[model samples]
Target: MGVPVASGASPLDAHELLRKGEVSRALVLFEKMHDPRRPDPAVLAGLVESRLALGEAHRVAPLMPHLADAALHAPSKDHHTGLAHWALAGLAELEGDHDRAAGHFRSAGEAGPDDPDLLPWRAGLALALTRQGRSPEAVRLAHEHLTRARASGSAYARALALRTLAAVDGASSRRDLLTQALEELEGIQATRLRAQVLTDLAGVLVLLHEDRGPGVIRLLREAELIAVRSRLRPLLDRVRRLLTRLDQPAGSTAPPGLEGLTPSELRVVELAASGLTNREIAGRLVVTVKAVEWHLSNVYRKLGISGRKELPT
Candidate 1:
């Protein structure tokens, strides 16, 4: 049998490296393990982290069944169950199942309130709630997560929590809180975290543009650069749409490609931009879900936007 690492260099060390952003080192350690059956839950979780950091979500999914089964059958109940739920929640978020995502996040939070990862899951849940028009509850829950993250001293958690706070605060017209979120994000150095926060700040700026015009444009441009460099496509799309809307001149003609969209497609785009699901859009448009999906596909092709997140207002 293969022996475990001695003293300070244990599987937990590998997990620590993963948490500290040393992804290559963590992956190397995980690859050297002798037996899959002997793998520490922390090491398995680190593997998940490494894959997620690389944006390999499909790869991460295969491991979820194994991890979930282990967590469910383990002798003692622990944070692993929560981690599994959070992983599934992340997949749901990527698939745009906001309701399911929120449920999973809530389960994760209740199972592992002290887990650093749970803070981000809670923040994500709060953002979903905000998008679903539960602004007051969203604001309250976001602040609660922010408080926990700050107390935990996890920079990643703090950054995500701040982004959620910015979103909720923007929705509730709390400009001062959004300003504070922007200032907090300015000091974070991680590229992915910085890119996400800059995107959130740009969004808040867009909401506040009535009182601050060029200022919002400047922030959006900065966010655009960061997002492009970081290869964060979702945030990049948001920045692009925000800049496009901001740059439209008063009484300007519709752009060339946008002019080709049918009125129904345009309405679908508007609702999609507001975060409505195809089913909801279908109900609003008095059409079948498949019809709404068809319109959205055509709209996406005409607009050259790949994701619903990129739909124009």
Candidate 2:
């Protein structure tokens, strides 16, 4: 039998773990390679990406400039430079700087031309374009990449292309595209990507039905569970916001007596106002009793009431 890898794996091993969504283990391995004297570009890039994926964007901000300089001035034109740029782009995207992200993705493509048959740069560009409101260009680029990915039989590429398409498509087509994307991700070990797909799928489901039907709530709950279990803070925050949004009725403003409360607080107030006890309201809102109590306390304080007995009666 071949020799087994040591407990402390190499940078390649760490990168492979990161790619497979074993981020915590990968971070432990990559941290061992941190050498300021002569930094390994591969290890640096992988560590940065692993940190980003784990929602530690702020933690890695100080090293981004150095990483960018190294990527831009690298000796070889290969995966290291491309990955460095991709990591930078991801950070920019997380910070809500689409322009910077687009520039970095372009630089990545320049550093190492994307494999059109597999993971195409055009696909990433299309997603950025979609966010920038260049839907027509995004659609065209997505079709090109999707066609090539399908022909090449790359499930990961096809899923990515489909998700890009779904983001730019109209509501009707968007639903179908997201559905197909989830199907592609379902068979893979990319748990983070799967959670993202589930979030997008939940968004589409909500759009398709304004009532926050059972199906939509179910999808969102699944996504939320994954985000929480993986400790993906960004996605967890997103899922919570989506849940809060769905809880409110369309064009719903606070009731006349409860005008000052926020949408979420107003929701709890309305549920309670409808004669639902604390336990019932908690169940209806899918929240804990403490959360329900907190909102009720805020509501009582704002309304200048001693108890629920004085609420709108």
Q: Which candidate is the best by TM-score?
A: 2
lDDT of 1 by residue, 1-313 (tens): 0112223455666666554434444544654441466544555666666666545466666666666665566444456666656666666766788787788778667666455544366686787787678888888988888888788866667666766786776555445554655565555545555555555666655665653477766766666665443333455667677777777322211323456777577666655654456886687568999999999899888878897866643
- Cα error, residue 75 of model 2, in Å, equals 3.6
The TM-score values for the models, in the order shown, are 0.58, 0.70
Writing each residue's lDDT as its tens digit, candidate 2 over 146-197 gives 8877877767777877877777665438777878987887777776667777
lDDT of predicted model 2: 0.70
Error of 2 at 183 (Å): 1.2
Superposed model 2: Cα runs more than 4 Å off:
1-8, 116-120, 248-313
